[model samples]
Target: MSRAIRRNSLTEQATDALLDYIAERQLGEGDSLPPTGELAATFEVSVPVIREAIAALSGIGLLRRQQGRESVVAAPGATHLSRLLTLRVAHAAVEDDAIQQYREVVEVGSARLAASNRSEESLRELDDALADLRAVADDESLHAADIAFHAALARASGNDLFVLTIDALQPLLHRLRRRVWSGWVNSGGDLTSIVEAHATILERVRERDADGAARAMTDHLAQARLGLDVLSGHVGDSPARD
Candidate 1:
């Protein structure tokens, strides 16, 4: 018999062991797990290592801990995922050209999915969100409505992974929107222009034109980037010739 390789590090092993214990024992959310000391001894690692593993999982929303009490397994939610997305986008923004390309790809894919999967009810919801956005055009309320509209489009994609991925991206999207909107307001760029862009995208989605919707969304994002760049004083409205 061949010996098996230990492919995991001690911290990973500890985390997996705890997770398996939770699953095998049918521990639901809010249920207390074993003490860290006990788990460390069981895994034959230092207590601090186990604590570090627990902390990592906790940061991802998979566990929660209280000082002097046993840690508990918790269901993951969008909050931690949102934070992760924001960090990812902020890091990407440091390399603006590369980030813009990636953002274009994601926006196109999301628009196609929205066109293909959106039902009448979901489309209506999107329309309602768009109306709300128009109503709140000059205020913070528009930003919230804008987020809701995008979220609804993600949900309409009919893929749980797509929905979750977009949900995770919400924080970054919100931050970008704030920057863009503020810049637009300051530069005297009409908010109605964005509304019209969204309306055009929505119409394509309603018509089930996946390619058209995708193209529309890409154009909208490009315009948004222009507004943001102008606001940040990084570039003029006119694009430079290559």
Candidate 2:
């Protein structure tokens, strides 16, 4: 009745064992991991194997390589997720479609949280992001504001998971926004409309209208997607789109 990850190789097993080691010790962020030799001895593996596992862990942002060639536990963050999302969007796999869908769900939840839990400082931050959006004279500046505003909104949600998810989605969101905005620009959708949609979401959040905030976010994303010429997946897998 033991359902466990079937370790297909020594390195795979060592990776799992290292995760277990961290969990068992309740290692806090920045806590020093056992020395490479100690870990190797505990796992009954060569130092090379332990080093391999540590490398893998670092790649995923779960472990930090400190100065003086030391390793420490790391607080989970979005760096790994951001890299993977950037690659996934660039490759345009079928699963890439699901990421857009996943974002909608996460962002809607975040919007509701922002409406319910936002602080005055968070509202001011949102206002600053909006002012930046209105001041943008070019698509590039608009895109920068677009990224910042959503990030601010997520932080206002008072949920760490929401903040991290929004952070990780930044690159992909930027790509999608660029694509959508280009099509919208050619088709007569103006930056003012985009700014207005976001303003509605912000106003709802400021008013503490949770339902209104969620609905506003959903509508905003739908409109943004609608502006895209075609929902093409994969760069070369499909015909070139505008």
Candidate 3:
């Protein structure tokens, strides 16, 4: 057994061992895995434990299994994460939860930094984006521009981690934005109201009011969630997604 393997949970040990093996061997997609018996022996665990570990990895699309054959490494993609986000939004609409809490933290922290660090040029860029969002008739275009605006704010934070985190979150955020806007439109909420909410956030940032910008962003997200809930006819109340 590797010295790094945990002595506690067999599942944890199995998971760590498989990940370490993949990393050390530089395994790639479609690569045949070693036999489960070999993995069981290597980890000093039962075949069933190893099987459970493989099943977990397969669930994440990180491994593929064949009858009477070694499992194969799989190409990991964003599909799993996208599904997670869909489930999260479906749950968040009805009950305030940790995901919403964490999202607020990211949004407020990024907005505050943006307010303090944004340059005149960046502000102008945001203005143009807002204008484009207002003019776009297609919901997809509007949602894309909205994401661009928020990502620009993250970049303005002058923090590389913040920028990367926001970038990684772009896909899910774009999906959520579309859902929210579609709901708002169906609920008879004016598009101008949504655009003006974003404008207020930008205005606060431009004025260098960090606290005000953070609050505005929180409000904007809360309203967005409500709008989505109404539009989906409470479909967002469920905590699971297909």
Q: Worst 10-residue stretch by lDDT in candidate 3?
A: 94-103
Model 1: per-residue lDDT, tens digit, 1-242?
99988788888888888778788889999999778788888888999989989988898998998888999889887778878867776776654444455567776788899899889998999899889978883557887887788778877778776677667766666667777777776767787888888899899999999999998898788776776777768776457522
In candidate 1, which residue pairs get closer than 3 Å at backbone N, Cα or C atoms, i.e. clash? Answer: none
Off by over 4 Å in 3: 1-101, 231-242
lDDT of 2: 0.83
TM-scores, all models, native as reference = 0.71, 0.85, 0.57
Stretches of candidate 1 exceeding 4 Å from the true structure: 1-13, 16-42, 46-52, 64-74, 85-102, 185-188, 232-242
Output the better candidate (1/2) by TM-score. 2
Clashes of 3: 0
Q: What's the true lDDT of residue 140 in model 3?
A: 80
Better of 1 and 3 by lDDT: 1
Which digits, one per residue and each the tens of the lDDT, describe model 2 over residues 116-215? Answer: 9999999999999999999998888999998899999999999988888789987777777887777666666777788998999999999999999999
Write the residue-wise lDDT of candidate 3 on 92-155 in tens digits: 7734333445567898899899999999888988888888878878778888888888878887
lDDT of each: 0.80, 0.83, 0.78
Instruction: For residue 95, give model 3's deviation from the true position in Å.
Output: 11
Ranking by TM-score, best first?
2, 1, 3
